[model samples]
Target: MLKRRPLAVLLGLALLSGCATLGEGGASRLDLIRQRRSLRCGVSGKIPGFSYLQTDGSYSGLDVDLCKAFAAAFVPETGAVDYRPLTAPERFTALRTGEIDLLSRNTTMNLSRDAAGGNGLSFAPVVFHDGQGLMVTTDSGINRLEDLQGQSICVGSGTTTEQNLNDAFEARGIAYTPIKYQDLNQVVAGYLQGRCQAMTSDRSQLAAARSGFADPRRHRILEEVLSKEPLAPASVGGDQRLADAMRWVVYALITAEELGITQATVQRRYNEAKRRPELTRLRRFFGIDAGLGEKLGLNDDFVVKVIRATGHYGEIYNRNLGPQSQVPIPRGLNRLGRDGGVMVAPPFQ
Candidate 1:
């Protein structure tokens, strides 16, 4: 027999355990944003046209813009963005360890990432729809996917590209080996060094990589797309409320663009936004009463601020990768609702 501990001691121990769980578990993405007055986003350190550090300590690219938009939506001040660069292997770990509140590094949304036993990361919404493809030296005469048979393909390790390539080749009974590298630079270096027959990744990444080569015309991207990659922002766990806020923030941008509301117009139409019923509903979503921000531990105007700061989804894309930009990624499947693509936003009502 053993003597029982004091009731007060047992109660105190229980409280401490509960507090421990609350400290980490209770901390939501919005909570972190409010406390730190910024949004901590995880991104790749050197992925050009996606997420890259600029000369002035600022992040620039499509992914970086999205993170900035998120921060603006969660907080009015556009400066409330703390960009944390991460690697392919470190992205999910950083989220799970609470080092970053969100992942916006052109990460593809897939089952393994959201699975409980896997990366345990949940997606927000599909921002960009891309596909895997191959890029080879134009002089090499590799023009089609079938040409990759028996060829060594350069690919990044721990990415969906590996499985996508395998699946495509397996279906056609073609045998090929993949030379996986830890970074895109290494993959490009190997391809340049004559170690790889071809390189494969999302077409956008392939394009970005191609632009960085010594001779852009030396390589040409294959026309065949292997898989549907719905690249999206991600967070750890299935926190529905937090995820919903972020998801709709993306939706709001799409909707705003569809409605032709530009960032420059947000101020002039400020009262118009207040008067419009649909806009009013959006305001509440961003926390104009209903204690929504308090519920998420964020400021009331978080979403509003994001919109005001970033314009909308269309603006973000066009600014970073549209026909006007150097990358010029064609908007294939990212068109708005009723525009032949599937970028429909649910009504805030």
Candidate 2:
């Protein structure tokens, strides 16, 4: 006969298993967000085209719109939000400590940042597809990454930007000095102040920073991309409920774009869905039939709320980083898969 464990030992094991289950399915963060009546969102307040504080004491940018979208989805019509401007180093800590419910900064999703044994953050779908690039003064005669082999590069500290810089330069056997700052604003300042010959960041960010300069034409982003940076929103890991809700929220943005559901056309599409019961996908997407949003622990009409608050992903992008915006980045890989870009979303069904 197989030997049985001691009574106390078996009880202890059972208790431990129960505790683990509780930790996994504990008091839902989604419920807390609903009860709190607002979302505490973290963002890099200094990045111009991503998230910036305006003269009118308002926040505007793609990331800012994302926060509003989340608030709209979670809090319904009012879209109440508390914007917490966080530095590169402070973003993760704030999320983990419950200081913020969502981090919509231009943060890259990497293995270390998403892994359970690492930063333990659950990331939403990528909202921005960017690449690391080196920005140098147009008159510097630097046309490529190798040109800065012996020069100092200004970079934001404690970010994937810095790591990608080192990796790219090292792989190419290009040695350089790095002047690090606590955040992107400081890094841009250091570059403008002549503390470094070049500044490295997401190419789109470089364009954003350049546009703010007195002479924007003086800076040029190198064509050689250093690395792929798929930026997304993040929340503290282990909250599957919150993660599920956030993931689907982002997917809603993409799905809206894929379905040609513009802000002005959302209600039209909803009406069509209502009148035509055969439009199965549109019916479920707009919450006319429910299920999708409820599966993520959100109101069935959250997608409709999000779109009304922030528009679809393309609209948000064009409004922030398109030609008319201060920071204009060609929607290279950010376009929909059908539009020859890589972005796509799962079916609402």
- Overall lDDT per candidate, in order of appearance: 0.77, 0.87
Count residue pairs with overlapping backbones in model 2: 0
Q: Candidate 2 on 219-267: residue-level lDDT in tens?
A: 7777677889899999877788888888888899999988889889888
lDDT of 1 by residue, 1-349 (tens): 2345677789999868844643565545676676677888898858666777778988788888888787776765544788898888888778876788889988888889888777777788888888987888878988777777898999998657799999999998988989999988899899999899898888888878776778776777776678998899998776766787787678778877766768887655556656676766555554553656555444665556666877778888888777656565657578786777778887644
The lowest-lDDT stretch of 10 consecutive residues in candidate 1 is: 18-27
Local error of candidate 2 at residue 254 (angstroms):
0.6
TM-score for candidate 2: 0.77
Error of 1 at 81 (Å): 1.0
RMSD value for candidate 2: 6.9
The best candidate in terms of lDDT:
2
